[model samples]
Target: MAVPALDTARAAPHTRPAPAPRPARRPGRAAVALAPAGLALALGLWGIRRENSMWRDESTTYQVAHRGVADIFHLLGEADVAHGLYYLLMHGVFALWDGGLLALRLPSVLAMAAAAAGVALLGHRLAGPRTGLAAGAVFALAPAVQRYAQEGRSYALVCAAVVWSTHLLLSAVANPRGRAWAGYAAVASVTCLLHEFAVLAVLAHGVTLLLARVPAPIRWAWARAASAVALVLAPLVIVSQQQAALVGWIGRPGQTELLGFLALTAVGLGCAVLPLRTSAAISLRTLALPLLILPAATLLAVSFIHPIYVDRYVLYSYAGFALLTGAGLEAALRAAPHPRAGAAALAAVAVAALLPYSIELRTPQSRLDDPMAAARAVRELTRPGDGVLFMPARRREPIMSSPGEFRGLKELALAQHAVPSGTLHGIELSAPRIRARMMTAERIAVVTDPPGRRPDDTPQERTKREVLAQHFRRCAEREVQGMVVLLYARPGAC
Candidate 1:
């Protein structure tokens, strides 16, 4: 008998109904999710204070968040508009409790914990309980995750939003409904607002939909949801683009970034080919593989023209890495002759391997520089009424967050305080004004990037250096991580 045409077969009766929008609730799933989340929270809290140290980036968060609401809003219009939402959220957090360092970092810790739980639940829904648990564990143990989990920045929260959004996107695809689509759009929109790079994840999700070959109607529903997200995010995109100088520091992808992506790409491809059993209506490989590679790959590609790729910008991709790893490990466990023992051994080995890295993350030295340490150095070297100068102006950040340390030391070139000026480092005097001011001081302390750092060529910075070198003698100098503190005395004053 001749087979019916493909279109005729599709139209024939008794076609399988689309799967339910959500997986059936299974017992112990909550417990499975909690295990990994708790682990992540514990790890996050482990070094939350980083020995009471905060780096330059965290100092920016602390100082920005400490400003009045109006000041923060005003600052965003001029710079850092991309981080506006996160800075506002942190402002609220600091308002509730001014517990200093702990308060600054707790939101990120909690956000990462939520991300861990979302990864687990997503894995469990797509694969099995074992895969879910393993994935969560893998996500929690990642060194990069641990590093960012304790940071005050928005990356951790952004990651959490994207991961949960991916799970919701899966729901919309499984059983296309108006409410499901709405939920996906709302969460996905929040993810992009948190950090614009997260919009790439939405593109990755589109690829997954195409690979799964959802019905035309479902595809259109997804398109609508994705469009809604874009509409919601459009304003931020436009505003942030006008302020694109914020990311000017980003450079073309380096060897480290290229090698890292290639290695993970190979691993993700390998995981996709592995034998696996999962409950997902569409293969987990299709979802996880695209999620793992697309966002970072797209950023890397774009960096060729304009360098906007930063690993932390697409940190949510690690959730995809964890899911693939979990599925692969779960499959291996089952294939072992003694599954329980093999799994236990595997856990032990992972812990052993990650322990040293975990310990290193908790140290102050792990960060680029300790802002507090630099502050202490400044405080120790300068006397009240002595003049203090920040070379290149931006070095003011290290001492800006700890005003008490530099109290009474005249800021020789500052025209206005940072918060009052609604700028990060505040306005500086003109070159002539700075030179005249330097002549009046008997002693001056200058904070600068450590020796061998390229000097700023700006007019203000050049005048500061020229006057110091020609008129003052270097009486004493101290080098701290990421900063140098030098005390200069007028000739014969030392």
Candidate 2:
């Protein structure tokens, strides 16, 4: 006999009760993703104008990019071979608005913002959302990042490109798509072109891939992509190598730098080894360990053969450092009784720690030399018909960015304008010619490097000093931010 069917419709009202309240709609992923970019932009732009003076390197950027396109290309072949792409990019920027220090540095600020976002995305992909946010926050607070973000340089741009390329690499491995691999190669090549040292990042990528032991298809894709990048970058490498003397000033790593590097390594390794919940297919350690260690380690090892281990050259490694730090911090926060409060406290501490460094980065003393201050001093002291001499010759770079200050004062040693001469400072006159010019000048204004620093001692530089000392007496001297400006007159003329 069929059992009487229960009146399910009648019982539904009592049994179903109130539908569980739908979880409140959280912010969209896209909105959350924008947080890193927004934060980076804010930090980078803050107090950017406070350090309005251009430094020596930034003066070079200004002088080089201000030249005509053809002149820039010509100069690239003879000097600054490694910075061709960056100069070209800056050329576009200056073309739009060559106004104040802000125009000069805005590109770097935007690039840093992009880099922070890319770092966040990389961390998110490798670990989780909290780690990503933490990584981006740490990157924004890094003193080095803050320093470069407000300077007119290629480092920040290179860093952004490298971080994005790593993100593309993750995507390529996850999907094994040809388009994804091509994108990775394109970005990697662009990054290397921005600064040839960025090519070292490939070795870091190699370590990651090897450790992962990815599928044959993915491995092949990576090989093809890497090979393409290398082939595209070969010409730049060879050209930059020929111009290796550009970095001759870099000495071997000092005790302080080495010790600092060791400390960084210890911290990175500690974070990498920490137990944290991460994707099974891709561990945070596998992704971030190589990036944090290998580029710097390889560069340092090569420094024995050639002293090319500048901390700024491997600045992109900081992204990896941030990732590891973020993951460790996230794990800590998660373990706390109140995760949200723990996170807030950690963030507060980070901000407090970085506040001083952030302020320091905005000061003229933070850089090697303040060109604007030097120019202002020169303008105040110089008189009509006064002959200007650049002791060591390269010190002329400050005036190159402020040609108006030197207008009416003859450049006693200049053979040609910097663009025409295709040199950082204008090509100097012959030693005899420089001496003759100095002898004829009734009054001369001299710009020299900081006190206690030895001059370059080239024949022309030595002649400049010798002629001034023998024929003229120092009437007055003013110490500018990173230079000494002196007024010299014929003996007894003062």
In terms of TM-score, which candidate is strongest? 2
Which candidate has the highest lDDT of all?
A: 1
lDDT of model 1, residue 169: 86
TM-score on alpha carbons, each prediction: 0.93, 0.94
lDDT by residue (218-238, candidate 1, tens digit) is: 889888988998999999999
> For model 2, what is the alpha-carbon lDDT of residue 431?
95
In model 2, how large is the Cα lDDT of residue 143?
82
Model 2, span 98-124: residue lDDT tens: 866888889999999999988887777
**Which parts of model 1 are misplaced by more than 4 Å?**
1-27
Q: What is the C-alpha RMSD of each candidate to the true structure, in Å?
A: 10.3, 3.3
Off by over 4 Å in 2: 1-28
